[model samples]
Target: MDSMQNAPSTEDTQRTSQPAPVLALLPETGVSYIRHAWQDMLSGMKLARLGATLGWLDIKLRYRGSILGPFWLTASTAVMVAAMGVLYAYLMNMDVHKYLPFLTFSLVLWGFASGTLQDGCTTFTSASGLIHSARMPYSLHVLRATVRNLLTVAHNIPVVVVVFLWFAVVPAWSWTMPAACALWVFDSFMATFLLGILGTRFRDVPPIVASTLQILFFVTPILWAPELMKTGQDWLLLDPFFPLMEILRTPFTGDIVNAAIWPAALGWSAVLTVVTFALFARMRARLAYWV
Candidate 1:
C-alpha cells in the first residue's frame, strides 16, 4: 500500500520535471522540409528496413528460374547496345567508335536516374496493400522503393560491365571508376528521395518525368560528343545531367580526373543532398494521404 502510494508521487514528480508543452511547428516552404526531413528519415529507418526486405523478396520471387537468373541483366544490355549501335550511329551521323562509349555510359546512368525517379513515384501507391495490412510507417515504403531501384541497378550493372569489356574500355590502375559509380549511386538515391514525396501525391508526375528524361536523353549529348563538333560549342554541356555524363564518360576517355570538375561534381552532390532532404521533410506529413 505504501509503495503504491509512493509510485503515484514519483510519477507526479517526473511529470512536473518535464519541459512545458511546445508550440506546433509551422510547416513552412522548401527550407522547412529540410529541417525536419532528416529527423523523419531517421525515425523512419526501422520502417524503411521492412520495405527494403519486401522489395528484395519481390526481386527474388520475380527472378526465380534458370541457371544465370540475373546474369541476363548484362546480356540484355549487350543486345540493346548492338541493336542501337548501328541504328543510332547511322541516324545521328556519329562515328560508331566514339559514339558507342557515349551511348553505353549514358544509357547506364539514365537507367540509374530514370529508374530512381519512376520507382519513387509509385513507391507508396504500389505498396498500398502492404501499407494497409501491416500498419507500418510510411517511410518504409520510400526505402523499399530506393532498395528496389538499387536491386534493379545491380542487375543492370552486368550490362555496363559487358559493354565496357566488349569495347575493351577497362579503366587504368590509377582511375577510380568505382568512386564514380558510388557518386552516381548517391545522386540516384537522392533523386528518388526528393521526387518520391512529390510523386506520391501527383499522379501525372511519373509520365511527365518519363517524357522529360526521353527529351533529356536526346539533348544531353549522349549520342555525340559535344567537343566533337566542327566549332567550339562545348558550352551546351551545361545541362544538369551534363555532370552525370562527364562522370560516366571520363573513364572511357582514359583521362585523369578533370581538376576543374572535382569541385563542381562534389558540390552538386552536396547541394542535392541538402535540398532534397529539405523537400522530403516538407512533404512528409502529406505523404500518407497522398499515397
Candidate 2:
C-alpha cells in the first residue's frame, strides 16, 4: 500500500515525457524542409549510377518479350508523324516538307518531356514497396524515371534522322541545343519530385494531372506551328510549355531559337528546383509512413 502511494502516476509520466500526439502530424518549418531538400540532393548525386542501372533495367523488362523491343516506340511515333504530317499540312495549308520536320521534332521532344512529368507523378508511390523494404535515397526513384524516359527518347532519335534524310533537310547545330536540354532536365526532375510527393498524399493528383495533360496536348502547339499564328505571338509566348518545347525543337529544325527563351527557361528551372526541393524536404520524413 505504501509503495503504491509513493509511485508516480501514469498520467504524470505521460504528460511530462511527450508532446501531444496530434502535434506530431503538424507540418515542419521552412528551415527544416530546406535542410531535408539539400540532403536529398546530395544523397541523390551519390547514387546516380544505381539509378541509371535501375532505369536501364526497367527499359529492358518493359520490352522483354517484344521482337522489336524499344524500337517499337520509334516505329509507332514514325507512323503517327506520317499520318499527322499529311493531315495537318493539308488542313493548315503549309508545305509538307516544312510541316513534317517541324511536327516530327515537336512530337518527339514533347513525348520526352510530357512522359517524364506524367511518370514522375507516380515516382514514390509506384516504388512504395521497394522504398519500404530498403534503405536508399528517395530521389533515386525520380532519377530512374527520368533516365528511363530519356533512354526511350534516345531510341526514338532514329525516326528523326530518317525524316531529315528523306526531306534533304540539314538542321544546323546550335549551342542552345545542349543548353536547353540541360535546363529542361532540371525542370523535369523538380517536377517529378514535386508531383510525386503530392501524388502519394493526395491520391487524386495523378488522374487530375493526366486529364490536364490530355487537354494541354490539343492546346499546345504540337499539331500547329506557333509561327502560323502571327497575330497571337504574344499569346503563344504565354504558353509556359511552348517556350520549353521550342528550345529543343528550334535547334533541331535549324530555326533561330528566340533569345528570350534562354532566360525564360533558365528562370523557370531555377524557381521550380527551389520550390520542389523545399516541399520535398518538408515531406521527406513522412513519405515512408504515408506510403
Candidate 3:
C-alpha cells in the first residue's frame, strides 16, 4: 500500500508527462490566418512576372498551332458585335452609327469583368495539383487567371477601336477612365481570391457562379441604355455591376458619369477588399485539403 501511494497515479503521470493536444493542419486564430493570407498575397504580387508568364503560356497552349491564336477571340467578338449591333440597333430604332460603338465598348468591358469573376470560381480547383505540390502563394493562381483574361480583353480591344472608327466615335482620354480601370482591377483581384477560395471548398460554386452571371447579363444594360430606363425602375442603377460598368463605359464614350457612381464604386471596392481578405485568411489554410 505504501509503495502504491509513493508511485504516481496513471492520471497524474498523464497530466505531468503528456503534452497538450495540439490542433494540427489548422491555424491558431482568425487573425493569424488572415495575416498569413496577406503575406501570400503580397508575395504573389512580388512574383508578378511569373504569374504573367504563366498567363501567356496558358493562352499560347489554348490556341496552339493556330495562326490566329488569340485573334480567334477577336474575330468571334467582332462577328457577334456586328450581328448584334445591326439587329439591336434596328429593333431599338437607335442610329447604327452611335449604337454599334456603344455596344462594342460596353461588351468589351463587361466581358473582362464578368470573365474574371467567373474564372475566379475555378482558380483554386483548376490548379489543384499545383496547390498540393507547390509552395508558392495561392494568390498567384488568381493573378495568373486575371492576366490570361486581360490578355483576351487586350486582343478584343482592337475590334472596339475598329468599330469606333467605323462609326466615327472618338473616345477622348478622360482621367475618370483610368480611375475606373484601377477600380476594375481591384474588384477583379478581390473577386478572384474570394470566389476562388469559396469555389475550392464547395464543388457547386462554379456552376452557380456561371448561372448567376448569365442572369446578370440580362439585368446589366449591355444591350440597352440605362437612360432609356423608366423612372420608377431607377433601382436598376443600384445593381453592383451598374456603377462599375458605368464608371468605365461613360468615360470611354466621352460622357460624364453621375456623381453617385463615384460613391457606389468606392463603397464596393472597400467592402469587397476587406471581406475578401478576411475570408481568404480564415480559410486559406484549409485550401490544400479541399482541393
- On TM-score, the leading prediction is 3
Work out the TM-score per prediction. 0.74, 0.87, 0.88
Better model by lDDT, 1 or 2? Answer: 2
Please give the lDDT score at residue 243 for candidate 1: 66
Query: Model 3, which residues run further than 4 Å from truth?
Result: 1-27
TM-score of 3: 0.88
Tens-place lDDT digits, model 2, residues 1-291: 999999999998988899666744666678877777788778988999999999999999999999999999998999999998999999999999998999998888888878887888889988998899998888899898888888989988998999999988876786777887787787887898889999888889888988988888888899998887778665666667888888888878888877787666666677788788777877889899877
* lDDT (Cα atoms) of all candidates against the true structure: 0.70, 0.85, 0.86
Q: Candidate 2 lDDT (Cα, whole model)? A: 0.85
- Per-residue CA lDDT of candidate 3, range 1-291, in tens? 999889998999889897878877962776688678889999999999999999999999999999999888799899999899999999998988878888999888888878898889889888988888889899899999988888989999899889877777766687887888888887888898899988888888889988999998989888998877768445765688888888888877767788888888888788899999888878877888998
Q: Could you give candidate 1's per-residue lDDT for residues 1-291 as a string of tens digits?
A: 888866767778899999999999774676665656666666668566676788798778768986777567667767887789889889878777667766777676677677787787777778767756765655566667677778876876666666667667756544467777788767776777767666777788889989998998778766666665677444543566776657656765554545555556777788888887766666676766666
| Top model number, lDDT | 3
Stretches off by above 4 angstroms in model 2 are 1-29
